[model samples]
Each structure stands twice: as structure tokens, then as C-alpha cells.
Target: MKSNTPLIGILTSSKSDGSIAGNGPLFIALQKKLISLNGISFVFIPEGMEVDCINGYSYSPEENCWKKKSFPFPDLVYNRIPFRTKEQEETSQLLFSRLREKNIPFFNPCFIDKYELYQLLKTDNTLRDHLPETILVKEKNQLLAFLKRFGGIYLKPTQSSKGKGIIRVRMEGPSEILLEGINKQEIYPSFTQFWEEWNEELLKKRYAGQEEIESAEYEGKRFDFRILAHAHYDNYTLTGVGIRHSQEQEITTHIPSGGKLLPYHLFQSSEHDEFFQTIISIIGKSLSEQFGFFGEFTIDAGVSKSGRYYIYEVNSKPMSFDEVDIEERKIENLCRLFLQLINAYPQEKNA
Candidate 1:
């Protein structure tokens, strides 16, 4: 392999994703590591990719990865694309196809469906113990059975995040049913009323019926642990953990939906530390084996009021949170993993 700086392209939704502003400095960490080879560049590969005319953004506005001009494809790619970027649907697919044809090393080659993962992981002996009872909501019978058995349940969309389309249902009696949504919630006088309205909606979109864990809470809000993990050599390393506390009376602790993100250390006094870490290790390995390749994942897990730990969700393309330390470690690992991948796939021209 020739000695030359490798360019790393980060796939993102927009040209100026200020959300990633936090990791801007850490990109320099990559440059420092590659000083002997020249230096490294962090580029943002945005939506609306043009054929052969593909353009990317540099961390600075004046570089080749900037939006000012078209640039050559990078040596490695880190897909940060949100599965729901409706505007870039067709182009994104084409771009990925091209990347594969070029043999470029990239992670998260495709988006993962929540239902697909729920079914696959929940069956694993190692992961099932930490997985809450989750089932795809295929019919009215399933939802009713879960609510009746668990007394409280959640209907979560199989393709959503940020707590969108999460409906909390609880039965007070045969006649009284509570239906809680994102912005507003209500109680129906009868099961018939709740079923008539909700049945049609739930049937329209695929959902997962999850037994709601009355999680351990601090103050008045329920919280879940977000374990940020990334692939390291042959194993997964925990970048860090952060706590997402629910909004007052909210069913989910998604930060965008008003949930609070506290550093994981706040829960240091709890006795489940080892369990939580173990769960992360198992999941990271399990997902890697299942998916073939994974760069990073955010696991939404928490401890129950009864001291049981359960994993609620796994995000393959997790967004960066606003925490400085966690974001730094996450970016550091990303660059490290990119170097590993890039070095392994040296240019055939040089080979």
C-alpha cells in the first residue's frame, strides 16, 4: 500500500448539519494520526447525490468536500443517512449501489427495520433474557391480549424513532381504556370506542406490541439508558452511556420529544452497572454477527422498578447526542474504525 492520506466521507442529510457541530473538533484527531501520510480530511456526503458529478462537503467551507464544488469519492464512507430522508430516497439508493460497485469500505450499507431486528434478536438465548416481550402488531387480537395481560402496553411503529407513533394503552376496566399519543391523550368511555378508532390506525402501519416496563425512575420521570457502542477490530466497544429521562408523564424518554439526557454517571449508585455493560457487549456482538457489519448502535435499555433490565430498541444509524465526552469517544472510534477498514481494503491499483 502506498503511503497517502485517506479521505473519510460522512453521509449526512443536509449540507450544514449543525447537529454534528459537536464532533467537528474530533475530526482533527484523525488528522493527527495520519500526519506521517500527509493528513486526513473529514467530508460530508449529502443527499441529492449527482451521477458521476457527486459532491461532498469538507469540514471547512473552503475545501474540496465543501458544497462549492464536485469532489472525488472518498476512500471510506460512514453512512449517517436517516432512513426517512424522503427527498433523497432514489438518489441514496443509487449512491449506495455505486459505492458497492466501487468496493469502497462503508458501514450501515442499508437501513434496519425495527420489526426485523425485534424478531431476530428476541430469539437469541443470550439477548432474549434482556429483551422485553415484543411482537409485531398484525391484528386487533394481539394488542388487546398484551394490554390485558400486561395491564399496560405500548404500540410502537416498526419504522419510527424519536418516540413518534408510540401509543400507550392501559385498561382501567372492561369499559374504560386509555390511549396516549405524542401531543395529546384521552380516555375512551368503552373498549369498543377505543378499538374502532385505534384498530384502523394501527392496522395501517406496522407496529410492535411491547410490554411496558415500569422502569426505575428518578424524580418523577421514567428514564432509559442509551448505550453508545461501536465496532472495534473484532469486538464492540462501549463508547459511553447517557440517560434519557422522560418528560413529565410522557411514555417515552426520547430527547427530541422533550425527554432529558443526563450523563450515565448520574445512575452510578445503582446496582445494575455490570448487567447494563454485559447487555451492551452481548448486543454489540449479536448485531455484528447478524448484520455482518456495524459501525455504531444506540441501545435503549433500562432497569425496571422491580430491578429487571430490558432492552427496548436498537438503532443502527444512531444520531449523535449533545454530550461532549460521549460524542468525542464516538467520533474517535469512528475515525479509528475507518482507518482500520481503509487500510484493510488498500486500492487495487496500488495492490
Candidate 2:
């Protein structure tokens, strides 16, 4: 028997006009790919408004009555919610909970619930080995100790993306550490110097916020890998891989920090070929078993001078597609994998 056709809903944030932010370039790419598939319909949901379940699209509050149409309910939701403030964060959680109670299939139910990801990884010893030295602490003593032991470290907000609110600390000498803002690049000689400089930068002289210190190197040119993993049928596959190289003095390879994305083949060499394949396989297995959410995920990983790959952070919802010279087969494989996952849900549920 043929399976039921799936109606996928993309839940995204609204612009000031209340329309969906679904027209972004990356999102457009995904939409185009999905549209190419047979028997699939796409619906959109914007925050702060109830969508109509008759039509497949909704209108913004700012639009005139003619544009204010109700959209149809979706069989599955692809969450693309962006959190800008504490209240928006809470609102997203509530919306996700409602979707769950309604029994709608969703990928990345809520991005704000990253604590669950951390908790899942904490118990996996083998997976933990691939991660860098990490700890959660709010005390200055803990930060100082981390800096002392690692010689260099990165201070980042627990809930930050695109490398915002990140600071890098490097040991300049036996007794001094150089602290610099990730974006501002303001330099300081010590923690006390950092406080003074930070106060001057903000012009209010107050403690900024909680920052997690991570051991990251900034002196050398750094590159990061974007490992795209997706579930196809019952197996998970690593789709297109890409590299991001820092073009500035930032310790991170995030695009916002003046980084450029390179093709995955750039890293494929006689020396690194074997290592790269092994790491990708390990990452795919780890994520599938840990999260239990079999969908496309982007894993950002870094390589040290010692030739070891360290998992930086796993992004549950990665930027969809980029305009690169990727092979047609790769793109087809990715699209096929996405459809496979969408198709597998009902079969798995029945079994």
C-alpha cells in the first residue's frame, strides 16, 4: 500500500509585519528542494498569530484583510524559531509544548531546550571523548582556574549563536593572560585589566553576564567543519560537508565573525581522508543514539595542531543550504534523505 502524503509546516519567526521569515535564502533553498518532491505540501506558521487550517498559507496582522487568510494545519513542523529576548524565548517554549500536545511531528521541537542535548551527552563516555574540555560554572575562580590550566580559553554565553558575547583569553606569559573580546578585539593584560576595559567599552561599569570559559586557540589560523547529518530510512547519513575558515582575528570560525565557508573536498587529502571519514561516522552514530531525533543536524567541529578533531558544538537547526559548487548527487542525496525521514515517521509509529 502507498503511504499517506505528508504536509510539512515550517514554523519560523515573524518580521515586524507579522509575516513569516520563511523567505530567507537558505530557507528558500530547502523549500525549493521540498517542492521538487512528489506528494508533499508545505505550510508556514509565524509566531504571535493563529493560522487558519483550510488554506496552506497564512497572512500577517499588518496585511490588509484580503491578505489575512487562514492556513491549513500541518502534519509535521520544521522548527526555525529564532529567540531574540527572554520573553520571546518563553513564548517559543509554550508554542512548542502546544505543538507536542497536539501530536504534530516536528524536527527540533524547540531550540531553547538545548539543556536536554547537553544532558544526553553527559552520560556518553565515548562521545564525550570527542568533545573538548568543557564545564559550566559562574564563579571567577572557576574561570581563572580554567585559564590557568588551558593557557588559552574562550568565554561564551550559554545561550548564544553566531559567536555573540564570546571572549578569548590567552596566556601571554607565566603570570599574565591576554583577554580580548571576540567581536570588539579589545585587548587586556589580565582579568582585572579586562574588567576595566570592558567597563570602559560599555561605559556603565557593571558586570556583563555569565560567560563559559572554553579552551580555544586564536593565535593560529582556525577552521571549522560543518558536518551535515540526516536520517535516511532507518540509517543516518552524513550529507554535504563544508569548512569555514576565519578571515579575521577571531577565535571562532562562525560566518558572522568574518569566516568563509569552503567546500568539504578541500579537507579531503591523502593524509586526512581516513580520519575525516571515521570522525563523520562517529558523529552520525553518536547523535542518532543520543538525541533520538533522526533529522538533518549540522555538527561544527574543529581541528587542533595535533591533528585531533574536537566537536565544538552540535547545531540542531543549521543554516539550510548555501550557494556553492556542490555536486548534483550530494544535493539529491540530501533531499532524498529528508523525504525518507518524513516518510518513515508513520511506519515507525505503526510498528
Say which candidate scores most in lDDT: 1
**For residues 1-351, could you state the per-residue lDDT of candidate 1 as single tens digits?**
333667766665543444432244444444444443444554454453555444654544234232344555668777766556532477766777677777777786556667788777877787788788887877767667777889888888888886778988888876698888777789999767888887767777877888878888789678888888888777777788888888765778887778887877778754556766666677777766786567778888888898878888888877767788887777678777888888787654211
Worst 10 residues of 2 by lDDT: 202-211
Strongest candidate by TM-score: 1
Q: How do all models score by TM-score?
A: 0.85, 0.74
**lDDT by residue (tens digit), candidate 2, 191-274:** 666545454432231112322223234335667777776655655555667777777655667776678776767566654545
The runs of at least 3 residues in candidate 2 whose Cα sits more than 4 Å from the true structure, single-residue gaps closed, are 1-5, 46-69, 84-91, 112-119, 193-220, 269-294, 320-338, 347-351
Give all candidate RMSDs, comma-separated: 4.0, 6.1
Clashes of each: 4, 3
